[model samples]
Target: MASDRKIYKFDEVVHHNKTKDCWLIINGKVYDVTPFMDDHPGGDEVLLSATGKDATNDFEDVGHSDSARDMMGKYYIGEIDKATVPLKRTYAPPQQAQYNPDKTPEFVIKILQFLVPLLILGLAFAVRHYTKEK
Candidate 1:
């Protein structure tokens, strides 16, 4: 059988499943779009079939809230070719740094890296002042 299914971009908001009943990814997170799409008031065709394209235009016309816009990038699951697609890095909470008793060596390195620029600036000023007196 010929399938009309299309491959979508991960940056595009989507919701899909083997049965196509559950809203697996909406705007970016896994959501239950099964009941919502059917009852979506704006009609289900656009939202349900919008799996593989930039659904931003469709979503804007649907009158969703600012929070919905925020969620859009969270559920987008599409193509991931770093060379072609410019991927937006969404900060995940569990993956981010948190208050811990032990200090991370990586954090120490980053702090030192930040200080290096200031040190260079100070060195440049000192050299300029010393050379002016000579």
Candidate 2:
């Protein structure tokens, strides 16, 4: 059965991200979701947003009903070539320092913590006085 199914590469899937040519991968299977976009119960945007991408997580995250899962058969186009699928990468901005609350000076944070409530209280009293005068 697997040999009978068409196989698509990652680049080929990425090319179909647009609304008119949407394709998605879920659990190593490629699906052309263009026709089903308008009919999707979750609306077209949900389908379009996953176009030309691996939507396995997105699809599973939604906790789709059994009926929805069953309906996927209609859009099954092929299986992805596992070797061609790109590895997911974590992005870190160059030359940017990560914020660490633990590393921050306690004195500065303490001053900010104290000032915030005082500022809020002062603003509230001012607003109350202004509203009373009106």
Candidate 3:
């Protein structure tokens, strides 16, 4: 039965990324979701954002319900040519610097902001008390 499905090129699927004309390729299957765009629970922008690429990750991440999964058949148009799909690069986000409570400039500044005023007021009170006693 899979052999009967039409195959679409990756380049051809790239063109339908607009609100009025949108297509999505998820797990190699092509779906023309234009009609369901406005009706989509996440709104049309969510579907439009997944265009021009393999949206399998995006689709799976949302954890779509079984009914949602079954609904794909209605929009099913074809399968994408595996050979035409480009290899995507793995994303590794930049590591954040380790926060050292004893060394961070922001932490030091916050401590100083609190303590400096207290120290100033204490010194002012001490000076006033001493001068008044004299």
Q: Each model's C-alpha lDDT?
A: 0.47, 0.77, 0.84
lDDT: which candidate is best? 3
Model 3 lDDT at residue 75? 96
Q: Candidate 1 on 1-134: residue-level lDDT in tens?
A: 11432334444322242123533333323344545553455645545544443334555566888876665444443333223223443431121124432346778889999999999999999999989954
19-132, model 2: which lDDT tens digit per residue? 566788999999888898657788666876675557899999999999988989998999998888768723312221244343357878899999999999999999998899
Model 3 segments beyond 4 Å from truth? 89-134
> What are the per-model numbers of colliding residue pairs?
13, 0, 0
At residue 126, candidate 3 shows an lDDT of 91
Worst 10 residues of 2 by lDDT: 89-98
Best of the two (1, 2) by TM-score: 2
Ranking by lDDT: 3, 2, 1
Off by over 4 Å in 1: 1-19, 22-32, 65-134
- Two-way TM-score contest, 1 vs 3, winner: 3
Please report how far candidate 2 places residue 109 from its true position, in Å. 56
lDDT score of residue 127 within candidate 3: 92
How displaced is residue 86 in candidate 2, in Å?
A: 1.3
Off by over 4 Å in 2: 89-134
